[model samples]
Target: MQSKIEKHVMLTKKLALSAVIALSLSACGSGGSDDAPSAPRVQNITYEALPAMLTFNEGETVRLSLNTKGEGASGLKFNWTVKYLNQDVTFTGQGSDTISFKAPNVDMHSTMQVSVKLDEANSTKTFGFHDQHLSLSIKDLNPPTTPAHELGEEVSEIDTSVLTTGSTWTETHKQNSRIDQVDSSYNLVDSTLIRSFIVESADQNKQVVGTNYCGFPDLNSMELNASVLSIKCSSGTSSTQYFQKENSFSIVQKCDETIVGVSTFEKKSNEAIASFGSLNMQFKNFADLQTKEVCAVVATSKVTAHSADNQEVAKEEATAIRLVTQQEGNDFELHFAFNEAPNGFFVSLNSFFDENNKATIISGSYPELNASSQSGSLDLDAKNSISNMKGTFNFVLKNDAGLNEAVEGDFELVLE
Candidate 1:
């Protein structure tokens, strides 16, 4: 009985193993097929056209054609539309891919947009439709006429003997020249003269002052006996300017064939020197020379002031001075350091002088010394007609603690 039972159990185990092998093969086959077909890919649409930008005149005819590029493109349906000034107009088959039409008349200028769309004949309303566009501008065909003479070629000449050297001339205008002083001596080699002028201009209704110097070159060869005189000037660079004078007054000044300024002047006086003055400087906080006379070099282009005792101050920093003079009443207010004054810790001063050689300091300040409260006064004694000057300055500076510190000194300057 034991052998029979054991044999029956072994047969049952063999049957179970056969069932497991069949189930394994079924799962492998149900997973996937290696040769299964893939989903269809989307089609790409492209085209080529001649004359990408089209321009036509009114009443003219134009022909435009498009050649499509894609798979199964020839089998696709085509729709052509033209839009102009918010209106859309549809065109029918001109053999499917070509358009030939006459441009409409336009009063001034007009633009037309032409487009073509391609799709399957039985396609449903959907996104991703393919289309191409072309822009056409139509206008009246009118060309500009040739000018009589090139601009700047039509200029006249004048006599130069009327302009006298060493004479001062004056003109009154809103933002032009007020006075011009010519040097007494002329540079014979280059036929030029040193000219200085005071100019005032309105910038946003605020007066702006500027001083200009130019080497006025002779243009006598160009001016024969005409009413207009033509003279040239150099800007100390690669620039050369031309000025035309009619009846002893400047009518036009040009550079690079462009007019820059126009003005008229009347002879003011024969006085050579416009105005002259001296400068004095001292520092209370720093130890150097207590006080010193300033040496000045004056020229048409610039005026430079420096300490006569170079050991006291460096040459570069001591020579930072610019002179500007304004004729107000009987006094010439000499503005020193104008826009070139050193900021933060440096002191700048301005003085005024009268015809009698009297001098006074109008303003003085040390920018960084006193941030809150600062007051100063200058006492000036004029030595001679601006050739020499002596002055003393007293300043009281108050810090945040309201503690007042006094700065006092004196100086002398002579023109060289």
Candidate 2:
């Protein structure tokens, strides 16, 4: 009986202790402070997110997000806007933690502003003490490229990509009265040059002479492409170029390193520098007078002259003929430019080969010979010194002032 009574008292003590502990736990769970604890609120937000870089291209899609501080993101409202210039742009998502949108087209997008505002679900969406905001700037993938000022027309890929197949680029720069050499600061800088590229192999790309870059530099270090060609220089003064036509394509380069020639030149336009081709044409001269700046070591031709009415004017005699050649893109041309011939005449016979190996003179000049017809057979003999000989030639020629004449001839000539 005494044991049963002791057990009942112990049980009563245990129950009393349990009640006290339960009351303490209840007070802790219910915020039992002198004043009611403040309700949770969104104090701020984290505007940072993954894919760290925010830069994007036109029509690119991207997502931005916001994280709340004083409150859970689910209970918070977000409003996002993109201000482009003076107008607000429409985006895909609002009233959410994240939003996505497409970039505007390149022509339309420049710099843009993106902003977001945060509000509680219980309050109207507007700027408030609890609300926070952030702004971001978006940029374009490609901006306007710097202009290639002195290189003539803007370069195209077809013009530069031709480099990989092995190309020749020549450059000649003249500043102040000097030719083929200059510095960054000068009175005036002019361009005139030529370069020959020989593709020995994939590993042996170099200039034809193996060491110089006429006007266009031999590419080195960087891979060859349409946009950039790097020069190989031991002096560390080399430049990078962008190629685009002619003897050398369009380029931004400085050529003074090493080049040699005076073959075919006009001083301006630099149009006639391609002094290399298969033109062994001998001059049909009317006088033995010393000629002016003709591109020839020596030349003489047996010829006849005529007037517009199909009448022979003079007998064949050695005069002076100047053979000048120029490379126009892919066309090779020979121009017989004469300052003066027998009877105070100014003329030119411009000739090129047709597909059938016939030399045809296409067009001539005003007060100058523009021979537009040809009927001929010509031969070049090395041992005999006969450059263009044993051919019966007929030509119908005209000047810009409409001086038309037809002259046919058989001549013996030597080009040395």
Candidate 3:
């Protein structure tokens, strides 16, 4: 009996051990198959587009474009579509995996919603220009004769939102005259704009460099979008600029930190015009902004006014422009708009793309102004030597008419 019991116990132990081993094997196989890794699932898509606002002067044809990028954006086809003023507009072969858009001169969309779809993922953007009731009422201590001068208390209500707070900007002017370097910066505040800068650069004409700095909350404003930037510059000083179109945009220097002008659009086009109170910024030339960047420079020139009309006045004028940027690279192109100026006044710019892939602008002239009394012998010479080009510039304003005066300055070119 004892032997039989012992045999039964041994047989039971063996059966239990075998069952346990089988169950462990099955569990291991199940875990191995279930936990196998798989490819990542894409998420967090973002959308971007150009011409944040499209402006059409009633019956004017308009163009629109769309661009997008994000996770899960690769190796996928796209569908580009638009809804303009309740109308459906579509474009074929207009979408791509990375970058795509509808060509220029497409249908006009007074109000628009644009969409891009790619393999189970999609994004959309809204584009339109609304006629805003913008009013400017701030009385200028010294006003120019234009719609701007009529701007009274209405100026107070004007879209100050365009001028950002917590935004800062700096400017400088280097010249041969006593006012070698004129420097200043701005800080947007609740009541008035805050600013400060200095002046230097005498005798040593090595290379007069001036810089201007600006600080604003965001890139949204009539001044930044399509308005004139005015400043009061000291007599006999001028400036040129080198800018980071994508990272660093600059403004024309102010003489003694005093200058004012209404930002207006360029004539015929939606571009803005730049003017100054008792001053003029004459843009001589543009330093090739590093490739793939948009640069903004304010150039000012001064001329004596023989007539109060601001027209028919023979004055010595120097030019400068406030330079601004968005990004920098080789695959980038720049489109300019006039954010501020008077109606019918035109603003034009010049750029140079050299053999070494470096760009050098000879100069830009505002060919749309009403009169040219100071156009006698004032010319910017940028076609000289072109080797080992160290960043150096020379500005000359010849008031041979003795009718008015002029000023000039340049910038330090830094390539990153």
Candidate 4:
């Protein structure tokens, strides 16, 4: 009987211990709930009227709408304010959730701070008031008044009919000049040079006469059309030049002055070359002692020529041709040859000249016969006190075997 009584006492103690643990857990789970209702969670608070970030021009209106996701938001009140240009301005919105105002004008780029306050304690069960802020960029909208001329706009084609033989045109102006020295690796060393000059041209035989500062060899011939006036000039080879009628009819001489015509030549010519093939070449040289540091190789050639019958004699897909030049002490030599000679009739022009002198074609034959003759001129222009140089080439290929070809072109290369 005593053993049974002890067993009953142990069971009673275990039951009391379990009951104490259960009470402790219940108190921990509802520590503050027994006194008052728990605070409601606030979430998804955001603006619906304006974007997170805003951009506007001065005098533009901006609108804002406030939104929230949770219970007890009906009694919330919103107070709006804007801080602009070091001053703060408060706004009254009649207890509405939306705010609207005009952006203030600013002299330059500026920013404004817009903020809203929500009275959550008075209107909802949330812990306290909520604050939201946004940044707005206000930009000046006035247009810029610089850049007097519109670039890349097509102008009217020049009327070349009135440009009769012996007719002369002249102009003078200022322009920005750029000089670039490139190394063999195509790295460029550049400088800006100020240049000025006077230019005059006559229609007869297309002779161009001007001061040494603006000298261009006399044009061998000129062709006029409804939209373009193409001029062919020879210095060492043949140079076929074109001017768009509708563009800036201003003639640029020695890459210096840009001349505008005081009087317009309104006559148009019916005869014009249909097409001229393209020429491509490149020049590579080193600008300094740096290895692999090379100047931009000038490898560009384009020519549009028509036969006497006005038929296109040159096609875009013809065999490639190039003009290469090398410096030999105080003299320079230029070679013109086909990348792939059409036949044994390969024609080449080897011209050499010194500084401040015209290039003379020394040797080259078309038919490889004694009667074959070749002649051409290369006129070098030292621009910006020898900062750079440009040369014009005009060559005539004549063979006793009935082959005759005239080539004219120009190239610009760095002096250094």
Candidate 5:
């Protein structure tokens, strides 16, 4: 029985093997392929370098970047070194696709190098820096402007007011007064005295003669305009003459002649002047103000004795004059004094000098001024002198001042 079973098992195994062989033969016969097509494998690589080059100041921050391009990397790494004066600064990074770092403070211009690697890719970038300092400066690009008038010539007359509202006689003429006087006579004591009266308003014009020469720069090459101011006598002796000739008085910045520069007054008073003061001035240093040496001026109201109606008269009238050198701490200011007369004064600025030494005076219209108050401006150049002051002046009279009649105006003067 055992021999029969073994024979059966062997037959079964043989039958199975026969079936597998039959199947293989049938597939081959049908033209079916035994081998199958396979998909293609792909791989990529990328790399970028950091800071090709850079420049920055000592205190400024330097930015570094890693440039890269690739695909399928096992790992990425970064190694950087800042080399300066044979010294090295080394650092490392891991798994980082890109990185940035600031450069250290270097004494001089320098260059730093960086190296990066990823799988089979490697890159290098160089950063450059230059050290520099910061600094600023100002200067005058042009020469100073010369004075407008010839040397030894008289300066334009400036008008200024005295602050004497509540002061005494000594204080009124000394401290509160904006003007100082100096002359050979009267011990060079310049109280307020008006002279060389030339008043030009709307209808009439006149001129005053002066022989004194001041050493002002001959700047007769600039354009100029004329300006005028009228101040009435507000206080002091009332018998002031209108026009007096051959009268000389020095309008000084100092009460004593120790301080010398002056705008002297000669041939004082005029018939048309009714207790008023007029000043005629030419423009100088009008263009080159920045380069000119400017000074403050004080207008003195001088009372001069004159003849009226051919009578050897002893009368006093106010006139205006200025000093060559400016008074310390005082700019060009206008002051009008009147004894309770409304609109008793009229101050006008008619002209100024341009850059090219020419005359420009105000003529057509007179600027309105308040006779009640004594304050204004005198924009004039002290370095140059003015000689010719021609204008026509008119006045309105008040009843309390004794002479309440119409006063006509006329003026004239010559520069050095």
Candidate 6:
């Protein structure tokens, strides 16, 4: 019985083997099998750019990608690089399917480029490489732009409403002062001033100016504009005039020469006068900056305090100015002392001389100021950013109440 069962099983196996052999022979057909025929496919590789813009700006993040399409796209490899003026740019990501890089600065005369090499990284046979390259132009982002001037409903004036709401515009002027006992120096007191205005939806452009920037009351009586911000606000006896724009503001204070023991007045006369003042600051160093403006770094020392005649004691080292030199690609910040003096008065002048010598004046004392006998000049080399300031000043430190001690001296600033 066991032998009969084994014979039956053997017969079944033999039958199964014969069937497989017959099927294999039929598959061979008339054509001898050399290799399997490939399916119909397109040979070209397609890729899309993440950012379609051909012309770019500095600091813009750029990316390139090879999208899946056609035959063997998944097997494709990418070699990527960015260049500025032919120099390799810093980039990120594995150079396989996609890569990214930030646009670097391009000088006015330079060019930018992005290159990618597409090929099969892994293949048994040799294949030609497909190279993709892009040459583009990038705009420099560090350079200052000319702000747009909007016209008010009234023609011939800037639209003050266009001014950013709640934004306080600050103006700094550097010019010679007029007070004989206060701000005056042929060279030293040229660049030191502070002024400002706040933009409002409802008559925020109020003027604040006085004699020597003395004092003023608020009254929106003066006519001004949105494109050109000018406000007239007088507190009481003194009249105030303030003008503002997108980037700067000007405060014109009509000085009352009759007022004494107050801050210095503007242009006591047509002639220049001897003047001086002690330099005080709100900041301890470059790290400190409370107010939205810059104060000059004035030298004060009992040892170097010189006298301009007799009552005018601020001279030479007493009010010698220390300024930060201009640097490329960095905002030129002149170290200033924003101090609230004993008499609640502070004076500063500024002249920002760029290619056009765009200079203005700013004063922090007595709230407002007027044009001086000497209009100051500043040579600001502002190519990439606001640069250094070089000028002279004459100042005085008044302490008549016998409350606070007089601080006076020489100062020289060197920033590397």
Q: TM-score: which candidate is best?
A: 2
lDDT of 4 by residue, 1-416 (tens): 12222221221111011111100000011225567865544433333433445677778887766653334344456767776644664444636677777887754334567776655443443333335567776765652222224322223333334344432332222222111111101111111121111222334233333221212224333233221222121111222222334312332222111111111222122222111112222222111111111111111112222332233444211111122222222212233322121221322333232111112222132122112116554444434122233445566545566645455655443312
What's the lDDT of the predicted structure labeled candidate 2?
0.33
Residue 305 Cα positional deviation in candidate 3, in Å, after optimal superposition: 6.8
Worst 10 residues of 1 by lDDT: 19-28
Q: How accurate locally is residue 300 in candidate 4, as Cα lDDT from 0 to 100?
A: 16
Q: What tens-digit string does per-residue lDDT give for candidate 5 at 51-129?
A: 3334444444444434333332233344444432224443334345444444555322223334333323222111111
**What are the lDDT scores of the predictions, listed in order?**
0.34, 0.33, 0.25, 0.33, 0.25, 0.31
What are the candidates' C-alpha RMSDs?
30.5, 30.7, 32.3, 28.8, 39.9, 29.9
Clashes of each: 3, 21, 109, 50, 93, 57
Model 6 clash count equals: 57
Across 97-184, the per-residue lDDT of candidate 2 in tens digits comes to: 6778776653211334565554444344322323333333244345333344434344432232233333333322221111111111
Residue 3, candidate 1: alpha-carbon lDDT: 28
Task: Give lDDT for model 6.
Answer: 0.31
lDDT of 4 at 248: 28
Candidate 1 local lDDT, 1-416, one digit each (tens): 12222221221111011111100000001233558754322244344543434677767876776654555445445667775544554454643656767776643334566776654441342234435567676754542211223212222332233334444444311111111112111111101111233222212222122222211222212122221223332211112222334323333443223232333334344443443333333434532232121223221111121122111221111111223322122111122221111221323332232111111222223223422114554454534212244556555545576545455555454431
Residue 27 error, candidate 2, Å: 23
After superposition, candidate 5 runs with Cα above 4 Å error: 1-42, 50-52, 59-61, 90-97, 117-416
Q: Is candidate 1 or candidate 5 better by lDDT?
A: 1
Q: Cα lDDT for residue 174, model 3?
A: 23
For model 1, name the residue pairs that clash: 157-228, 158-228, 293-412
